[model samples]
Target: MHNGFMRVTALALGIAGALAMGNAHASGFQIRENSVKNLGRANSGTAVAKHDASVVSNNPAAMVNFDRSAVQVDMTDINLDASFTGGGTTAIGTPLSGGNGGDPGSATLVPAISAVFPLSGAFDKVTVGVSVDAPFGLKTEYDPQWVGRYNAIKSDVKTVDLNLSSAIAVTDRFSIGAGLILQRADVTLTNAIDYGTAICTASVPGNLGASVANCLNPAYPFRPQANDGNVEVSGKDTSLGWRIGLQWKPTDHLTIGASHRSEIDHNLTGKADFTAPSAVAAVLGPRVADQSINAPLTTPSVSTISVEYDFNDAFRLMADYQATDWHSLQSVKIFTGGGGVLGNEPFQWKDTSFYSLGGEWDLSPAWTLRAGIAKDESPTNDTYRTPRLPDKNRKIFSLGATWNVSDAISVDAAYMRINVDDPTINGATSSSGSHLTGTFKAHADLFGVAAQFKF
Candidate 1:
């Protein structure tokens, strides 16, 4: 009973915080864009040399032949369509409720940025550069009155990375390079509805039947029940982390590159709010609850190996393989009032691998064309999968082009389509018997443009 009470208390506090923050948010903080064509192919820019910026994304040493120092800027935009399908209507009871669970709206409008530069003539054989990028992040939002509101309303996981690197040409036939990285990240997690108030209301004399019956099935539950959706939690956190990389060029026609990016750990500190009707509050302890917590953010390390072939001056091909040590994110830890622990849930993620292939074709003196493809794996498991993070393995196809507008300037544009397979999450009852199960599907589209300047 004590454990149950403690869990209930934790749930109550969590819900209160979410409500105060305004429900309907999600978090899966993973950013997937760094370059235009590269993004079209699952972000595989490590072994290709199509432009001066390529030196920064792949190997700094590739700059050994740059006639002059340069700068590159890229902007990427994204749109998405996500939904919950194949489930009957139902209600839940925690804070207070009278609604059904079905469809949660999809998320959209993501942006990513990056910049790079070279050292000097004194180090003609070497190049130094820096770039800012996001490797992991996501955004999910549900309706305010949706059954899943209590589980997640608005979720945003984002990050900022700053990297410093040096690339050197050991010989005309070989180039080696390395890098040091620093990163800062922030996360906002929001949950809606109040289960405590809903549970108490359901326990009243004549309300036990609906609660008992719905608790037995896994589809959905109506209000005035222990698990009848009425709880919400919302908060934010920020912290610091770092990574490293290396590259090798064995010949003018072949460039082989390898790199490693370390994990980013953020300690999120923020406030929460809770709201319930008076009747519900009488049983839940209050009509309003407010407090703060420290949430932890984990960004994993990635190791990659890739090879690019310059078949001739007008054509090139590249392929890469990357392993992300997602296992580093095993669980979520939040600190609450009096510096004590509030919630500690297992993330239970494992390492994931990615594969990519790309090709560039010089169509004429003034135009270049590019195409690529790749596969990306998800890090979340079925048991832990929530509406906020309905992630699954996905396939990507991309197309891009560059127009040489002048002797010192070039413009680039690229497009990508991501196909996300339907993802599923099996239901499990809390010790209190609040059952849950869901089938989720989602996908995204992206457009990117950039300007390359040489002096």
Candidate 2:
């Protein structure tokens, strides 16, 4: 009775899904487009740089730098270009191998809004701010009839964050900030099923060897019917995390800041939606129905420290370091509400680090030019690379400018390009018969614009 009751209670979290794909913006799904100023600087100096209200996304302590109320609105357009080339391609158990998967990459638009205000009286040393942005997301879809259909059709994951933060100046040279973060996450992963392989494994276990091979090729008379249907797992969840930071300014020309953001554990609740041929459905039974699935995912935490130095106000140099605790995301495990195992994706991701250096040069009283470069370590290795997220080491180059319309109004525009080290997808997945071997070349272009209004 106790065991049955425990099973019932776990089901209350609902059934959901899990998805993984590469993010060109930052390590893992970390999106750093909160401000065009920071993006132009390759996301460096976010913890210490002062430009707009969007600084709340970095270190809340930076908010104290703004004496007047300011509102910042930003928009970023991303152009994704990725393609796979087949080389020694083969699916161990299925006869599905063809040309390149036809560029699964997709274009995306990310937006952010934030505001900061000062308080009077005893709260003169305090500044309050709020920010809303989509911090993580990307999507990739391949042709339904592609060679890797059984591996991936559509894989996407997205997260939106709402942060409310406040900063207080303890003294002239020191300040602190903290925030409450509320985030929502959604996941969708889809793939095709080889009908012949399922049936042979079920009915004719004795003669399964020759059946799958023959049925996979249409030219063979023993071939099973083509188009056996597809499977899509979808899930959604909400979670809470926290952020804290401190800023220290030893000299008027030098600024330093450190910040730590907590990880969010999400129990996504959704169901498995399957559509298979009649015979295949009968064999799979409840597995293909609206059965409950529960996928637990822990987004990684990050620690960042940044430094900015002003050289006579006309030229500024900035550097920063970021460490992501990706070790927590060791795997994507899914289960039924009744404690039945559904899927286990061994991500085995490792903690990674990022380093950046940049400088901003004042062209005139009204315009400033910014350029930066950064290098990111990959959390994943070649051993676990999959079609879902063929992540690898990358390098970034950025350039932008800030146009001050007046003292109270300014516009920031920037562009960045990312180059992903050519990576090979050669691994097995949760499915027994799924083995994918190929190479992917992926790159991205980012353009952003932000307007700041001070009151």
Which candidate wins on lDDT? 2
lDDT scores in order: 0.56, 0.75
For candidate 2, the 10 contiguous residues with the lowest summed lDDT are 1-10
Estimate the TM-score of every prediction: 0.80, 0.91
User: How well does candidate 1 score on lDDT at residue 191?
Assistant: 52
**Residue range 237-350, candidate 2, lDDT tens digits:** 999999999999999999999999998889888877767677645545554565677878787888999999999879999998999988876767778767886766666789
- Residue 439, candidate 1: Cα error in Å is 1.7
- Residue 252's C-alpha lDDT in candidate 2? 91
Please list the residue runs of candidate 2 whose C-alpha ends up more than 4 Å from where it truly belongs after superposition: 1-23, 87-94, 204-227, 430-432
